[model samples]
Target chain A: MALKAPLAYETKHHLSYYECDATGHPSLSMLISMAVQVSEEHGNSLGLDTAAIQSYGGGWVITSYEGSFAAQQPINGEEVILGTRAIANNRFFALREFWIQSADRQVEYVRLTGLFVYMNLQTRHLMSIPQAVIEPYHGPEKKRLPRLAKARELKDVRFKNDYHVRFFDIDSNRHVNNARYFDWMQDPLGAEFLTHHQLKHMTMRYEKEVRYGQTVTSEISSPYRNENGELTTDHRIVVDGQLAAASTMIWYE
Target chain B: MALKAPLAYETKHHLSYYECDATGHPSLSMLISMAVQVSEEHGNSLGLDTAAIQSYGGGWVITSYEGSFAAQQPINGEEVILGTRAIANNRFFALREFWIQSADRQVEYVRLTGLFVYMNLQTRHLMSIPQAVIEPYHGPEKKRLPRLAKARELKDVRFKNDYHVRFFDIDSNRHVNNARYFDWMQDPLGAEFLTHHQLKHMTMRYEKEVRYGQTVTSEISSPYRNENGELTTDHRIVVDGQLAAASTMIWYE
Candidate 1:
């Protein structure tokens, strides 16, 4: 009998200076992109590439993500390890986990969990997961998967900014890159807060997809203490008064 | 006698899907970023890193770029070679050449030449090239350097779009990433032209540095035939009615 493919995969990446922000660390969007890249690589390694998945008339789309960051983030030009693992999947839902850490494994920079669902690209509706695509990972089928943390609604908006989505913002997936949400969500906080504070934790939920040539208004509430006494901020991306995405971020000085 | 360092340097980079556009090839901005990265690596290899150059109270700033692309472009997940060579320099200016080719050296994807000048970060004024910074490259001293192709002024604007500079667009250099100009310049062309056509040659000139929180208007002229009978377009970026950057791009279907 042939050995089964591993459920997890890891790859080494050199953090280029272009990937880093003004803080000299990898930006949140780039980190998310890295995770997405690793997951795709994992799928490809298992012979379930995009073509194979799309052949089932659907593609995987992320629904939500919750993650935390370590105090020490990897700097530009540093070599780090990116990893992803298939956790569980059912007929309609799949769960995956991701992380970025130092080469020696001494420092884990980020840890994230994402919930995904197969969607029919032509109709843009949820669809049942394909067995041929999911079975290769060997993730046990679960009747019910654990839910990701929900993003809180924005209340008492203190800052708001409007952004026009440009052409380059879209990727090969034919939609705005999901990682771009972090940019819109965080830009309203201004550079002062961004430079002085570091993101400790975040929960983001994508409610709808934003298209090209559309404008998005990102709003954020003033920093306040949460139940855990952490400095927290609530963010929401609205399109024509409809909430497209929401997130809550915890920051530390 | 000590041997002088080589005037040219080369490195390999794997093009990630995130770096590519909806067309499944690297975007113009990402290609420029890759060139900038290799040039920085070249400087570092010669013991003239950013810190060493900043010690002279100035940094290298690109004034112009002119490049041509081959019929074949590298796609995502492909490893390509990035190379840079210090061509020549004078007291106030330097010229460098860059290229991106296949790993096997069989296909030359992009060949570009950039004109650079040292600028004082605090005063934002042109400064004389520092000896310690330029001498290590071993580029011959020139009385007068060759000028890049000047961008034609946009006439009879057929399309225009506005872009709000986001915080993430700024890099560690504390200003907008220069490569981003390519996005602003090409976005107004619309997706139809971008998807069906491939950039054959381009010449871009930067006039003023764009800052955060500023809205820039990008304008482009309709496709017209040039003297060489090649289909061409003219692009210009304006800030507060002032021309910030200009470019001319030749495209092939």
Candidate 2:
């Protein structure tokens, strides 16, 4: 589903020089982090801060994320607005939409939708969403929530790579941050391909987790031409030869 | 001289989850990035935005940085105050101070000082700082600025390892980011030492640049006990058997 939300919370961020990768634009991980930051700001404004949620013995856990990038991306030293809001929710899942746009809001940079499940920090089990947590954002509380479409598996994978999990990739959660998987997915594609093509939309499905001291292999299929004649790529990650994550991207040549 | 600026330019930031490392504390690069972020905010407030600075045909280029960490560091989802100010400067170099503290400003997490030189972007040649650029900062201009204490060379090096520069390490400048050298310096120290010892203070001096696909070897000296009962370690990085960067760190047992 596309991200459609009335912008109720907005935060302005300055892109730092270090935030950019070898390319001039912001990295995928940094973009994802900015989205998460804006969402937290929105929550803090509504009194649903991390401590407030943790007070209930549970916290929000992202189950899936799908994002679409515009043709224009934010560059270093540019001011970008990161806005987010809770769009909808069900008994167990809360759907939020996030956007990164130019300072004037006239140009949108990217839009993202994330499915969050309430999980207990102690037991690490799924839990019901508390009413107090969702009452402020004023998102609809429906019984059923939409699930993100999964990326199709690669059938004729050509390129493959083995990546050693670096200390920098792992977060406080003791596992690799989900956003980092995007780097691995693109690393195998090489700088030549990434520099020529611009990413339009990408979907990430993290089925398993990669921990520190573990090595994961990534496989990519040759660029496929869609009906619209645009370029597309399929990616899959495996640990111990078991599927860990799958992703797909539509790129503009 | 140390980071003794009168704390004036301040910006509050919410550290994202992806900013943390395996040990659960904010990673070194992200901490340095946040410092840069606040410094930019300080510049923008003074009408010294990138566009305005570029009009002079030169921009602020960091020549060296020295930082010290407090015992308490922030974790994921924590709000921190990033403060920076131009304390002193000369015709060629500007000395600035930075700090990361708790939101309440009660507990300081880290303090840093950076030496910046004005450089012509096109020619990559060092240039004198324009008075118009330094005037808005309201910093004291003098004939000479304090230089950062150099990182002592390592001797009797026992531990050594090689790290191939990843494509992601390269920035828009087509070279590795200066802060990334810390990762290489620390990588050779191993996870066991990193997990136990806390970084209290460190000084880094960039002698040479590492490019993509280059293998850099890091050599670390044996642990030495200072008079104050603190631990100290010195490190040096060599590319093709030549010095690239060197660093020193003080750790508490």
Identify the leading candidate in terms of TM-score: 1
Q: What is the C-alpha lDDT profile of model 2 across B7-83, one tens digit per residue?
A: 47987776766677777788777788788778877888889887799899988777677899999889877888999
- Candidate 1 interface RMSD (Å): 1.1
lDDT of 1: 0.91
In angstroms, the error of model 2 at B97 is: 3.0
Error of 2 at A43 (Å): 4.6
DockQ scores of the candidates: 0.74, 0.49
Q: What's the TM-score of chain A alone for every prediction?
A: 0.97, 0.90
Which stretches in model 2 have alpha-carbon errors above 4 Å? A1-10, A41-59, A87-94, A118-144, A156-159, A172-174, B1-10, B22-25, B41-61, B74-80, B87-94, B101-108, B117-147, B156-162, B171-175, B187-195
TM-score of 2: 0.82
Instruction: Write the residue-wise lDDT of candidate 2 on A1-253 in tens digits.
Output: 6644444789887777777886778878778878877787788788877789888879877777888899988887788999888788988889899999999888999999988888886677889988887777778777777677678789888778787776777676555677778777887787778777788988887777677767889899999986778788889999998988898888977
Q: Can you tell me which runs of candidate 1 are displaced by over 4 Å?
A: A1-6, B1-6
Worst 10 residues of 1 chain B by lDDT: B1-10
Among residues 3 or more apart in sequence or in different chains, the pairs in candidate 2 whose N, CA or C atoms overlap within 3 Å are none
TM-score per model over all chains = 0.97, 0.82
